[model samples]
Target: MFAAIIAAGVCSCYYDSEEGLYPSISSTCDTTNVTYSGKVVPIFANNCLSCHSNARAASSGGSVALENFADVSAQAASISAAINQTGPLSPMPKNGSKLKACLITTFDIWVRNGKPNN
Candidate 1:
């Protein structure tokens, strides 16, 4: 019984690492050449489009349309603020989890590059 208890204690002492739990969460994020269509759009599609899409914008996105380049460009600064969960703006994605660090970095790079349409 004592040996069984020792084994149980050892087994229970397993460490949980963020990277180990989230294998898909990459450590190295390449932010080079970030673009509106290629990088930005896909990020929006995955995290923001459900509510901020053209169709859903009116009813669920608080009328904030992120479905296209023009709309996104207009709100680029605020979008960046929201994604970073900083400044006075509310954190984006409402009840959803914050975007991955790599994704946020990519968005920041895109915005810094003058928010190109490409």
Candidate 2:
């Protein structure tokens, strides 16, 4: 019985905010090049879409279909605002962790750089 319980617990999924952020931030993303092809799409794939993508039957928020680059390009500002919004009901990934500081910095740089397509 104890072995079965331990097996069940080990197989269950959990989100680790730090694991998702700092290493991915440094390795895969460059703030200087925050384009749809790079920074934003990957972040959405790894974090947001598990809950927000249309592929999930339980997805919320109007089929935000973030499975591709074009979707992200068109929705950049809205995405940015949602990520940065502060209040009782801001719509982010809804993790216990606040969006990582480096992640926010990268988004700001991306916006400042004309929201490029690179």
Candidate 3:
């Protein structure tokens, strides 16, 4: 009876789906209408601006400026690589955690969409 009870208890443990375990990992990331001002800038503001903004670029950002649209646009590929923590470039947020996959996907979509300022 004791052995049966223990086996039943062990078997009763619930298994969580990946999505349930990580609710933030969305299966469908809406990348349509991604724009520099609306999407890209906010991502930079939240993550890169601290070190890569114009004011701080020369000091802590290794001279990389991500505050303005022009600079951001020019370095879009590098930025993507860095944030995605891929390729030869250093992973961004530099010493911090990588950006969420959705955010990276959004950036890639923005880049693909000709990198509009809107």
Error of 1 at 83 (Å): 0.6
**Worst window of 10 by summed lDDT in candidate 2:** 13-22
lDDT of 3 by residue, 30-105 (tens): 5557877887888999998999989999999999999999999999999989998878999999999989888887
Q: Report the lDDT of model 2 for residue 6.
A: 90
Error in Å for residue 72 of model 2? 1.5
Local accuracy of candidate 2 as per-residue lDDT tens digits, 1-117: 999999777556323443433444664544555666677666677667876676762556456766666666677677777777654445677654657756765765676567677
Q: What stretches of model 2 exceed 4 Å from their correct place?
A: 1-30, 87-89
Cα TM-score of candidate 1:
0.75
Give lDDT for model 1. Answer: 0.83
Error of 3 at 42 (Å): 0.4
lDDT of all the models against the reference? 0.83, 0.64, 0.83
TM-score of each candidate? 0.75, 0.57, 0.75
Q: List the residue pairs that clash in candidate 1.
A: none
The root-mean-square deviation over C-alpha atoms between each candidate and the true structure, in angstroms, is 10.5, 13.9, 9.9
Residue 50 of model 3, lDDT score: 95
lDDT of 1 by residue, 90-112 (tens): 89878999988888878877876
